[model samples]
Target: MARKPDTDKRIAVLGLGRFGGSLALELMRQRWEVIGVDANPAVVQGYADQLTHAAVANTTEETALRQLGITDLTHAVVGIGTDLEAGILTTSLLADLGVANIWAKAVSRQHARILERVGAHNVVLPEHEMGERVAHLVTGHILNFIEFEDDYALVKTRAPAEATDRTLADSELRTRYGVTVVSIKRPGENFTYATAGTTLYAGDILIVAGRTRDVEAFASLG
Candidate 1:
């Protein structure tokens, strides 16, 4: 008898390139059963021992995917690089196979749009996102930053001089700076949720959220 698929934690990653390979390994570290698929026999052989299952198969073909039991998996990632046609076809095939969750990588805005139209549940432009993130980190005091689709951003940074030595309510951060401190971490202490009455001190770290420009301005304050 065939073992039933664990839809909750099992995933199929099609393409063993850098981004896909890294994501697969990390998912494995988190205890997910990962099936790595690629057309290159050498690539499959390289990851055969590391992944839960690795196979060399042309992912763009529906028959090939079915032969590999990809239809049984609930989640799939189309990580084909550069070959836009192949990536699109593979994503479409996964969608047709009734995979519940589909993630695909896009190299450009047009590619992202096409992937979405072709039934990709999620599309990521890794290089563009990484470039934006790196630009923020290098240009500001932010230790980390994540920007959303709506131009809002969440960032981690040290408490600015104006924000420290005062309660959040008294500081009037939202009124003055247009940003909200979501949480704070004092030296040697774990992070705690921030409240209006929460007081900030120098050297404390803060998790803040606001419009991207507002957050950047607030972090720039000395």
Candidate 2:
């Protein structure tokens, strides 16, 4: 959905890493006034002509960031990935400056835990998570899934061996596995529902829900 252009919403992105650069460009494409900052001279120069204002500055320096008026921005992202210390320092400074929303990137598990403890609103480890997803796909029998919270997950897994050739009511999946069959997708345009009196086929994909471990175990059933 296209957003109605709002010229007044100020957004700032610190660190011109690949992720930050893409985010700034996207915000600009949506007609938002964006301020992109980075300490790298080459990165600032490369995007100088692309953004509303691009500058080379130390984002972790509270004084420098305050002078940029980043506090006035509605949202900001601290996309420092290479240096864990810099990422944490920049995030801490942004929180101290009272930025309304702050999103940060983490390179490791410990790094993510620290960012959360330091008052960052959101933490992301995109590369690490993507690597896991890709590995799952490559190994096969791992249906598509997404983690919504630490414990719960929404997954689309292949029908378990016990569920094959069984109708929804006969499967007893909800009572046994504690997973709700949200939907079922068959070949072509066919789809079965939780209420559908349909028998499962060999290649059918079942969109299920439960704890993460439950989902993993079900996916392992060839």
Candidate 3:
């Protein structure tokens, strides 16, 4: 589905690292007016023509952020990947500026907790999230996986022959593996939510969700 345009949102992305740069561009592509910032002049210059606005400033400093009018932004992203202290400082400053939403990237659990305590509305651990998905893929059973929150995941796995010709209730999934079969995707068709009576078939893909451990166990079965 095409996402609704975010034309009304004035966004600021501090940190022009790989993730931050890409995120700012994507938001602009979705029609959001974005200010891309980075302490490195080279990075800022590279995106100058591509973004609505791009600047080189020390996002950790209050004065620099104020000068750029970042405090007036409705949303901001502190994507400092290597500088943890700067990331924390930027997040706190954004909160002080009363930005409605502040998102930051954290390298570790401790960093994530600090970001939250410092007033970040959301903290992301991209490495951990992507690593989990890649690990599942290497297992060769999981077709796709997404982590909505820590310790839980939504996974798509191929339906084995034995699992076919049976209703979801007969699968004993929740009772045995603690996963709920949420939907089924037949090849070349849209997703269909799985009901208790929904029959599974070979070659059908199942979307299941639950504790990560349980999801892993269930995927291992196929």
Candidate 4:
């Protein structure tokens, strides 16, 4: 895993809308030093004293951002839900100022593509990703799965009918399922693959890791 900086964890959030406000609150709750910015004075005042620093400024202007001293920060999140042009400009300014990580929330796929093009490290589509995960689980037997990275995932699925009544070694599931059998959760036991030689009774949930499509296909086999 890429380690975040060991120095002071400083985060700057632009736009004091609900998404930005909530993120600021959560970061403050974790004891992170946060600087929050918004174009509306009232919105900035709403989070006064809750965040490390709150200011009213238009982030689209490079001069205003420089004056706000936000360029010194190492991390920033652009949470503007509307006026994507402002978000893209602010993201570009942050990147120019050498912010190591910039997380920009996009309202649509086109917006996300533009943000990424503007040097944003990550473009977050919270609703889209959540919907995809929910739809996947609703349509398949996967209890839960987490996307670890672009090409990797961790998934937990109910043992398939064919997977029941067989030992892990007997199943050759790695070859068959094309997923690494990380572990198994029997009704009351957690078994690692090293010890998967034991019997797998029905209803045992198998925790596996692989590509998203592979994991989903294996999960649907139940």
Candidate with the greatest lDDT versus the true structure: 1
| lDDT of the structure predicted as candidate 3 | 0.87
Q: Report the number of clashing residue pairs per model.
A: 0, 0, 0, 0
TM-score of 1: 0.95
> Highest TM-score: which candidate?
1
lDDT (tens digit, per residue) of candidate 2 on 15-66: 8889999989998999888899999999999999999999999988988988
Per-residue lDDT tens digits for candidate 1, residues 1-222, read 132343588899999999999999999999999999998899889999999999998898989999988888888999997689999999988888888889999999999999999989899999999999999899769899999978999999999997789999999999998999999999999999999999999999999999999999998874
lDDT of 2: 0.81
lDDT of 3 by residue, 123-186 (tens): 9998987887898899898989887767888899987676789988897778978999999998
Give TM-scores for every candidate, taking all chains together and pairing residue i with residue i: 0.95, 0.81, 0.90, 0.84
Give RMSD (Å) of candidate 2 vs. truth.
Answer: 4.9
Give the better candidate number (1 or 2) by lDDT: 1
Model 4, 1-222: lDDT tens digits are 242352568889998898899999999999989999999999999899799999999999989888877777778999998888899999887877777888999989999999999878988887887887788778768888788668778788888888778877888877887876677777877665635676666878878888887888888987
Candidate 3 Cα errors over 4 Å, as ranges: 1-8
User: Which ten contiguous residues of candidate 4 have the minimum total lDDT?
Assistant: 1-10
* N/CA/C clash count, model 3: 0
What C-alpha lDDT, on a 0 to 100 scale, does residue 32 get in candidate 1? 92
Structure candidate 1, residue pairs in collision: none
lDDT of each: 0.91, 0.81, 0.87, 0.84
